[model samples]
Target: MAPVFAHGQLRLYLLSLLNEGPRHGYEIMRDLEQRFNGLYTPSAGTVYPRLAKLEEEGLVSRSDDGRKATYTITAAGRDEVARRQLDLGDLQSDLDRSASQLAEEVRSRVKGEAADLRAELKAAAREARRVARPAGEPMSGRAGSEFERQINELRSSARKLVRSRRTSEAVRAEALRIVREAQQRIDDLS
Candidate 1:
């Protein structure tokens, strides 16, 4: 499950990733895709501004490597990450519950088909990216179409998963698959 947030969860996730070492923007995003399986990955469009904000706040330090714009954590950022790590579990649980609740709603109302909590969680991530799509960028072509299609398929899968799910193992299996798929997408994009 992802961390619960109406927004800016990606910022926290990025800060947490950067706490490990200096990395370029692409690396930070790819790490998230790896961690979440493919169900979640932050985009450069989303991550870069958050990095800038952390820099402004003295949490992250910035160094331009020609064009790479490498980012590293400052003491304050590390402290922030430490504090947040304590609550990371809670955040993920809350997100899982939210997706479960969404699935329940779908099951009760729409042909008794539940949403897969796992897939719904991925849908949430895709929604975040959709919101982050830049102005004047057409949602067309290979990349955009692939993203949109994945979002739709995940939603469909989630609904089915939630409706028929009866075992913890099944849930875990589906979730693991979603995570792997999302991570693969990030790798391909990178």
Candidate 2:
């Protein structure tokens, strides 16, 4: 994967953030994570050094309330932000594009995984049907149809869930739990 921020871009972006208002290190990291749509999370090693450098350059001033240090943009920081308005705009555009691409890739991967799961479930169901049936006897028509219908319903629901943009981690966890439970029940049959 490519670096999220180009050389010197993070420093400039951090300054731009401070230009908005005073912020602590954790808040800056959280803001970056949010701006990147959870695609990028900055470590303290990445952010704090840049902040210290900015303070050393007199671009930002810091105040400590004994617990944490809050950084406020200095006149120089605001001036720099004002001077690089065009760069900031470009950075914002780049971030938006990257986030969108990453999200699409995630969605595509999830769809593929869901399809794989469906295939595995179908195969397992077929094996189970074969094993449970007596030799020279066919499955009951109504029972087989109902079982296939339920499998199809599961596949359809999984596909829909994978495609939904608003699907949250909790929803995904519940879906996973259901899949696991179904797999466990299938194992119990064998």
Candidate 3:
């Protein structure tokens, strides 16, 4: 995956953020997410380490209050920000580009998933019709009820997984592959 920030850009951006005012770690993360228009959100693992590095370099100072540590920019940090005023614009432009790319990737992935889902559903519907009982037969029985229940459960699970934030691209891709394979197997059974 392409990174949102170039090599040392995240450190510089963190300094710039601190220059704005003292902020807790979570606040900084939220700021970054908002800056990227919800396309990118840095995890705590990413943010805390950078904060530690900045603190180590004397660019920022941290004060612990209860369970939370707030970071404030030092004078040196402000000087660094002043010196990199030109680079700041470049960073913002890079962030904008990254967000656009991320959005496009997301759109493409969703489109592919929709196409796969539609294809699978159509195939299943066609198969179901082919195997369906005669028109005179009432569609109410243990088998019909069980089939309906299973289909509804499958729909609910798919919706929940797709909507979850924890679902990675690999997971989604694997899921689609599994569905396709299942469809193939069902077709074979016919």
Candidate 4:
């Protein structure tokens, strides 16, 4: 994947964020994460050092309220932001492109994984049917049909979830967990 921010771009971007309003370190991180649609989450190690650099440069001022420090942009910071308005716009465009690429990659991977799971489940179902049948007897009718229906429903649901742009990371993670557990149980059945 390409770097989300080019060299020195994040520093400027952080200043722009501060120019909007005063914020604590974690809030800045959260805001960045939200901006990227949960694609890029900056660690404290990444953000705090840059913040410290900005403070050292007198581009921002920090107020320590015992536990947490809130940072606000200085006059110089606003001047810098004003001076680099075009650059900031360009950076935002780059960020949007990067985020879109990342989202597409995630969607592709999820779709591929869902397809793999479907194939595995189908194979497992076949194995179970074969194992459950005697030499001359067919698979159990109603029970087998019901199991097939459940598998179809699972596949359909997984496909829909994977394809939905509105699906959140948390929801995607939980769905993956449930699918993996179901695959494990089905494997055990065979």
Model 3 regions lying over 4 Å from their true place: 134-190
Model 2 collision count: 0
> For candidate 3, lDDT tens digit of each residue in 90-183?
9989988998988888777766765666565565555554445655677788657765765675567667766788665654775666567656
The digit string of per-residue lDDT tens for model 4 on 80-128 reads 9999999999999988998998888777776766566556656655655
State which candidate, 2 or 3, has the greater TM-score: 3
Q: Can you rank all candidates by TM-score, best first?
A: 3, 4, 2, 1
TM-score for each predicted model, relative to the true structure: 0.46, 0.69, 0.75, 0.72
- True-structure Cα RMSD, model 4: 8.0
True-vs-predicted CA distance for residue 175, candidate 3, Å:
14
Better of 1 and 3 by TM-score: 3
Candidate 1 deviates by what RMSD?
A: 18.4
Q: For model 2, how does the per-residue alpha-carbon lDDT over 78-137 read when each residue is reduced to its tens digit? A: 999999999999988887887787777666766665566557656656655554645456
Worst 10 residues of 2 by lDDT: 127-136
Residue pairs with backbone overlap in model 1: 37-179, 37-183, 38-179, 38-182, 38-183, 114-159, 115-158, 115-159, 116-158, 116-159
